[model samples]
Target chain A: MKDFEALKSIWHDQVALPKVSHEDVLKNLRKTRNGLASKLLIEMIGMGIAAAVLIYVWIASPFTMWTTHLAMIIFICCCIYYILAMISNYRRINYDKLLDKPECYINHLKKYKHDRYIFNTRKYKVYSIFFTAGFILYFIEISFMTSLWITVMGISFTFLWIALCYFVLMRIYIKREEAKLEEMIQNLERLHKQFEDTDQ
Target chain B: MSKEAQFKEIFQANSKKIYHLCYGYTGDDETANDLMQETFMKVWQNLDKFRNQALISTWIYRIAVNTCLSYLRVEKRQAKDELTDTIIETRGEEISEKNEQVSTLYKCIAQLEENERIIITMVLDELPYAEIAEISGISEGNLRVKIHRIKQKLTELYNRHERF
Candidate 1:
């Protein structure tokens, strides 16, 4: 009983709260950037969707009217947005930048596991709904020569997205493997620390 | 409330508990501190997705455990343990007076496999076996059995080291 009491006291006294501050926001931002596989997967899905959207539009009679032209222009703009998203991703990868801004990180990680959902949902968005919708739109605009040209351009851009995704994935895979190796080393180090503490 | 206010409340309430959880796993004050901050930062970032099913404390513990586990993967425990010895030495009287039993308890704890250690820690923190089982994705009955074994082992270890 005395021992139990003593142990409890020690547990309380020795265990102090660690001081964690806002930088953790940045740290997590860094972690997202560090998650290269996820990023690549997202990019690939995005490209695949763009391609399917193009094909769907081609099949659906290709819109050429002034209204269709405007709509196609909007679609192209969305495509450009997707492209810009991909480019930002690449730049992030290149600079080793993590999306660690405090507002974004806190909102994503703590406000609700928003990041996890976003992380999980990104694949579906790129590969399924977005792609399907995009292709259908493209086909509607297909009657327009301008739409055809845009579709062609979109296909080319899709290829670029795929190439970039592949490149990023390869790099991320290597980093992930490296991180795994590092993890193993850390475990061994902890064991060694425990042993040494015992010796002391 | 605005985002900043909400974030601040979470940081204040959970930071210490999160740190202790990390320390319980890492046994390093500084690393545990860093992990605690990281865990909260994650919680803050993912706050919106928290459907109120589980208690906030449970969620925080989950994050702390995962973070510590991942960090452990990269660190060389051997090197850190050596440094831990130095820390223990420097803080000998401070730690020893606190109760050598706790350190002994932790040493044995560190010996358990990762899953076992986590389950036991959750138990020690007074988390119900049901919650433990839920977080671990195991049956409550199984958790009871595992907890019994862990306690038995811990008792045996505590006795073994008590004589020294």
Candidate 2:
């Protein structure tokens, strides 16, 4: 190999840079800050819809059965729990936080990745179960009012939607997310290994 | 000078170095630009917090290293087609020999570990051992030892690539 000095000179000599003015920097900073705010707003909107549904059903529905009330409460609590967990995890992706010390960054990424995996694989199952169970209970009371055919169709559709959410929709999302995190972790581990290789 | 004016002057002086540091890690212009800007963005945001206890160059280089490492991602592979198109359109019909050498150097840099890349880049840029050690949060003696091993590996990698 040529001397490291030669390589250093080459690095120093290569100075081609695309023009980036101060205006560009300030504009992009504002854009990035807005982008973050919009992401949080979108997350809140999702939970807002969930909460709105909870209120609409609880207040407007005439079904007075104890099972219906219990099921609604279960669904509400689950939504709240999911939202809280998502918000807390969201903080991990902050630009400042992710750029902590190298080892700490890797550790944070690993824990965040693991928690996301659980939220998809395990937590989703539990979530589906409770939600499905709640719907079944709600449907039972509705079965009293609707015709037999309508009741059967309604129940079938509910279960089918839940099945699609678990087996198809959520699965695709989980796989994509997990793969992205895995790729990042692999890069970080490679970087960390570089240091270890040097030290040893 | 006002803080903003000071920052612009600093950026004018060091933006190229920061860009190359990023370019060395990613081996691509587009990603390097993104990382460089992200690094500077952090500097802008945290400029008030910089107490001047460390050399400004060391401090900014650390930020550049951490930013690039943190944002290293694989999703760009999916955009390979568009990236190729962009590269061709920008570079035009001729590829210079110097450009190839620089590209080869960066590709070699990409082979090293993240910390090694950051450290070696600092060394190549000729930052003093004391300042490099200060920013790296390592002692100068340990840094000297690490730098030796890192240079050896980089030389080996560079030779291995030259053979191909």
Q: Per-candidate TM-score, first chain only?
A: 0.28, 0.83
> What fraction of the reference interface contacts is present in each model, in order?
0.20, 0.34
Candidate 2 lDDT for residue A118: 83
Candidate with maximal lDDT = 2
What lDDT score is found at residue B158 in candidate 1? Answer: 64
Off by over 4 Å in 2: B1-10, B44-59, B72-104, B153-164
For candidate 2, the TM-score is: 0.81
